[model samples]
Target chain A: MTRVVLVPGALALLPEYASQVDPVAELRAAALAAVRWLGPEAAVLGDTQGERVAAALMGAAGVRRGGTAAYLVVGNGSAKRSEKAPGHLDERSFGFDAALGDALVAGDLSGVDWSLADELWASVDGLRRASPLVSGSAAVDYADDPYGVQYWVMRWGS
Target chain B: MTLRLGRHEFDDDRTLMMAIVNRTPDSFYDKGATWAEDKAFDRVAQVVDEGAEMVDIGGIKAAPGEEIDEVEEKRRVVDFVARIRAAYPSLVISVDTWRASVGDAVCEAGADVLNDAWGGADPALVDVAAKHDVALICTHTGGAVPRTRPYRVEYDDVVRSAIDDTVAYAERALAAGVARESLVIDPAHDFGKNTFHSLEITRRLGEMVATGWPVLVSLSNKDFVGESLDLPVGERLTGTLAATAVCALAGARIYRVHEVVETRQVVDMVNTIVGRRLPARAIRGLQ
Candidate 1:
């Protein structure tokens, strides 16, 4: 049996980028709670920046790196969810994120369009790589893109 | 170092706003605007509403005029200090005077800080502060007598003189049984110096901050700002806040200002730019 948790690669979650009034307080709390369920030791899978965010969250949540069974994956959906999003408004974002979010909750991401995810500025590298490890219905902890970017915090079984 | 201003304490990284509330009728700025006790009370209320962490209540105007004796000074600020203390328990009430007699009177009335604006003219003020266990603002006036204007004062190095004099006064206050955290230093801009001296002090304020004592800058609508911009009293606020930004960059801890909102904004903005303060609520790009 393996445990897996997924969090957004939001740079604001990093300690060094913190603001006096945290903009991502709820998201960070959800991500941290999800990461903690990955157990004492977990393997991180993400792109360069995503990995840095994962490391910071692990450090904050007291999660260590050793065993590979407990996987902490960092990724997110479209950045063009709205006009103010990082990638600006893209009508394709809603459909793309909907498919991706469904795939994540259903625990099957093999049919995701990597090219469309890249066009929408979605970070799916870790999610794509961790496809084989995720199974069964995921326990969705958080799902929203308040900043025009899509973010989800979900955990797969032990 | 943590700052203990009477019953209140602040972390070292926190900056403070000490709004000016004049009880004198002839003060250089806002002449007679808040001279009436009720009017002064209103001023205190206004600053508190505007988020002033402290209020520097001055009885006698800084400039020379008809002699305001110790009794008159006490009559002006003591009851007012008690009134403010009763109203805003958390507010740091600073009584600005160089007379230890009036200092003692106000301290008994619940004043928190003894702002010796004349740069320790009455040496016993520290003793009074010590007895009350309150904070004292040790200022540098180049040994100028209380309520006397600077007469063509010249310093080989104005910043050096300010640092040396203010630090010595702080040391004296520390030795007089005042808590080390309760002693603050001020460069006393335009108090006993010409525009040039004041400018030098403003430019090199970091040296004063380097003394490890919290620095209180009273730059609001002073002569130095007027001379720097050739602006009149009402127009000098811009120049004052500009100088305030410079001092904030150099890490001044307390700002004595007539305009609390504007000064607080300028200090917060400058400190954020200097990386000493985090953005109030930043989500510009990392969202």
Candidate 2:
């Protein structure tokens, strides 16, 4: 399955799109929802636009400082129609996530170099074998096109 | 019979919207639709339903440097045109080709117009178009016919060069027995132009209108837009709409575009501006 690793602090809270513009609040909500899908052991952390937050989030997401796995650096950016947190991400970090939606969902960890990006993507074939984030039924279909993948993580039953 | 291509009307107000159906296997967009009879026919119906007055079917990719083998080109053209002909018997079909052999097959298969990029440099194509009694849109981009002198940005005469090339193409069509009115002329906007020259010609499109026949202005998503707006092809829609508005204001009878809905709106708005000078009408009526 494709591996999608998201580092916190990559997200922004922009008021321009305020169905509700509160990032911390939305992250809390997302955390609550993800636990339903990923189980209670799944830790939820938000990525602020700061570097320290990025490093901590990347570490928490299991992205070693210098490894390659498909990374979906989710932060404040609009899909153009909805509220997205705003913070500048270098183009590759932003673009790769947007291009390959499937890879971000599958969490494919191989072929990715995490050090090259504050955020990036790779296929972690082993993670699928070990992690409950993807179930046996889900593992078969997790790897997706690796072009541009930015995903909101939900580890399999927590 | 009076004919209309799209929004620009002739005798019958039914403007023929000639949807450009490129069946090139490597077309920039919609490449997979080529040679697949079902997909190609579906595209034909889609464009026609989208209010295309006619469908311009082609086998070769128009983007620079891509060439199709003459035999395969002819076969694809014939097969697609014949199918469209059989399906929409009353539809006005224009064959997009500079190649004489392919042009011959489609024309013989009941294509109504010959839209040539080279302006009849191929004498045989002109003869084919003439024999088929089809209307011809003679177009010239600067590159299609090499300039003995490198194209100068400083034109001692912009209108003369545009009209001269168009007139020459019209003369060739006339010599081939195409009716004078049936020949439409376009100022091949980006085909051989620097920005200033292109803008200059566009600003003075009336000079082309002065040539007496109808004018077809095709500034759709061309280099001029990309260079000016610094936008890729997909993002050139707004720029395309602006150029179409300018072309319509300058009296271009037909506008070739990828974004049909917006192009139609811009032209209709321009037509409204031309049809009734609203401010003047409003002032006089109020007075």
Candidate 3:
């Protein structure tokens, strides 16, 4: 089975921008655990900013990119889930994130509404890129949008 | 350079709050608020709860009043220091006295730093600090006697004079066997300094920080803050915190303050802006 891990592209996870208290502490812990379980080598899939978040998480988890069938996907849901959210409240964010999160946990990325994710500011390009091979069931270690930006830490495969 | 304040040790980059707990009946700010022993003890508990890393226990008011001799000053601070030590073992206990007898008595009672606000009035105070293996606050007072207000005390270059006098005092403390890391220099604002001198010191505090010795600032509700804003003691908190932000930017390590929470916020915010410290919990757009 192909090992796969999914984590949100939160800039707070990077050591350079860290605060004294971890704001994304639980999310970071879950991300690290899943990444560590991904073993020493895996293919990293994400956008430009997501790639940076992936690299930081990999370095922190002592995992690295190498030639392997396993995949580490970096992406997130909407930034407009509330009035205080970065993109402000967008009513479409609710239905969009609901469908997206369900698709991720079920490892069925083919149904992701790419155009709607872009409109809602959801980062799903990496998951979109891995859609063809994403077939196994996922175990969610984390799932929440504390800052109004939906984040999930899920692992797929044995 | 880790700070060694008697039994406690702090990291080099850490900025500390040294809350002032006056035991004087006529001190300008509190005006005998904590004159009684139990009231003073309550003040200690309050500052410690408010996150003050140190407490500067002063028995005598800064301005001239009734003369408090060695025996009287010792009587005022020695037991208070011992009681605070027994309660808060981790707290840095500093006794604000210019008398060697008071310093020795407080050190015997478990004091940490000797904050000589009179610019080394008692030369033997250094020896007392050395004898106790504690920290010493080397302050620059322009040769003013203890408890005397500044009267037309002019300086050719106030910052230069502050640097030279404070560094010289620090060296003197070093020669008297005080540990180099244990010595902190302060440009004692309003102590033998006019409003202009204090303002200049606050403006060019980086010169004092450039001397490589950790700087301690006692800008809490002082006359300079009052005179600058034309406000009374009760109205000088904003002014004091303004001066505090400047000193913190210039890399002052310890703050002797009356309002612990406000000063801590100002120092932490200023240090965070200057990159010396991190934000307590930043998660605005980075989430």
Candidate 4:
């Protein structure tokens, strides 16, 4: 049997069943649907909301955060860069302050010590010079983009 | 303030954190977020507390500029770095800009390295780096990208071209005076490439190791990761870590990620596999 290189295309939100249901709730369902495609031995590491999708996966396989079957979370700040254009949030779009990002990321993790200023500030300090406000003007303007939220969660737990 | 400056040194081979500090108000996410020096310092302290190994500071932004006078740019850059250095004396700092004067100013103010987006745009910047013996990272920027291409410009071959261009730029920087050991290469993922181009380059970044210098893959939730999956900026964590892991497997020496703790974990895991390898095999009957 040929070894498959599984590269799940970017996670897609499910089509809205109706106007009443929350889109995020529907997205959670779609994410759960996508988890079925992963191989047993394969582990996942990427960004998403907190651990809802991963939690759902855990329910399916009967696992926990640090159990035999495990996944990780790396909550993101924004989803996409521009409004009209489409793309994943780049490092440059993580958040406003370290504290804000930490608060957001804290929602996704457990057992890790999270303070007010998680790591957003350091991330900001490192790249701000190369990617100054003047340069990132376009992205800033696109803040209203639905996918521009700067949170990412990677599922590693089973 | 206690600031230290060095490369991304890992602690117990876990993860190394290099926090980002933007002095410019025009930065993408928190545009005008750090317009005030106190606010910038507060952010810096937050990253340090959260666990960052080094801090990178920049006066100018990453996008193309309309040929501003080199002297004015240098003066503006050095002034801010000087202030930062004085205020936070113990922080390990890196200055981001391709101007020679800016490099000199930061070094004079005690910065440890010079991160050049244009990879020595003025060549004098190379001299500044040599004079201070500062570590360097070079990223390739397009002179201009055709508007017709919109975000998706053409690359002869994304991976090969990126590596070649980076190596060429590194060679030039080295020839001008920057030391090889102090040199690092960034493929300039978002400088001009469109979504597809960025993804192609990032996914196949291992090819960059052949360039013979440490590669720093700074793909912290970049645009390509979002577009590929139709994710909004807020929903890119899965994509970001996935991208980081891909580059790490490609032999990236340093990963400039925004999500520190998470990226740190992935880097630790990937580096374990990349750092260790069964020794090279004897050539075909040559040995």
Candidate No. with top TM-score: 1
lDDT of 4 by residue, B1-287 (tens): 11112322332223346666777666554565876777877877787776666677867656544344557555545666667667666656787777676677778877877887664466677778778877778776554331112344677787777777678877876787766666778886676678877788777787887666777777766677888889876678788898888877777766665567787677666765565322122111110
- Number of residue pairs clashing in candidate 3, backbone atoms closer than 3 angstroms, sequence gap of 3 or more or interchain: 0
Model 4, B280: alpha-carbon shift in Å? 28
lDDT tens digits by residue: candidate 4, A1-158: 11111111122221211222243443344334334433343233332322333444545544334422322222333333444223433454433433333432233222223232233211111112111111111111011223444332222212
Rank candidates by TM-score, best first.
1, 3, 2, 4
Task: Please give each candidate's TM-score.
Answer: 0.98, 0.57, 0.96, 0.54
Pick the DockQ winner: 3
- In angstroms, how far off is B2's CA in candidate 2? 5.9
Error of 1 at B221 (Å): 1.1
Write model 1 residue lDDT over A23-136, tens digit each, in one string.
999999999999999999999999999999999999999999879879999999999989889889999999999999999999998887778988999999999999999998
Evaluated on the second chain alone, the candidates' TM-scores are 0.98, 0.84, 0.99, 0.80
- Give fnat for candidates 1, 2 and onward, in order: 0.87, 0.00, 0.87, 0.00
Q: Candidate 1: which docking quality band?
A: high
Model 4 chain B scores worst on lDDT over the 10 consecutive residues at B278-287
Ranking by DockQ: 3, 1, 4, 2
Q: Return the TM-score for candidate 4, rounded to 2 decimals.
A: 0.54
Give one digit per residue, the lDDT tens place, for model 3 in B40-143.
Answer: 99999999999999999999999989988888898889999999999999999999999888899999999999999998998899999999999999999999
Each model's iRMS: 0.8, 24.0, 0.6, 26.1
Name the weakest run of 10 consecutive residues (lDDT summed) in model 1 chain A.
Answer: A109-118
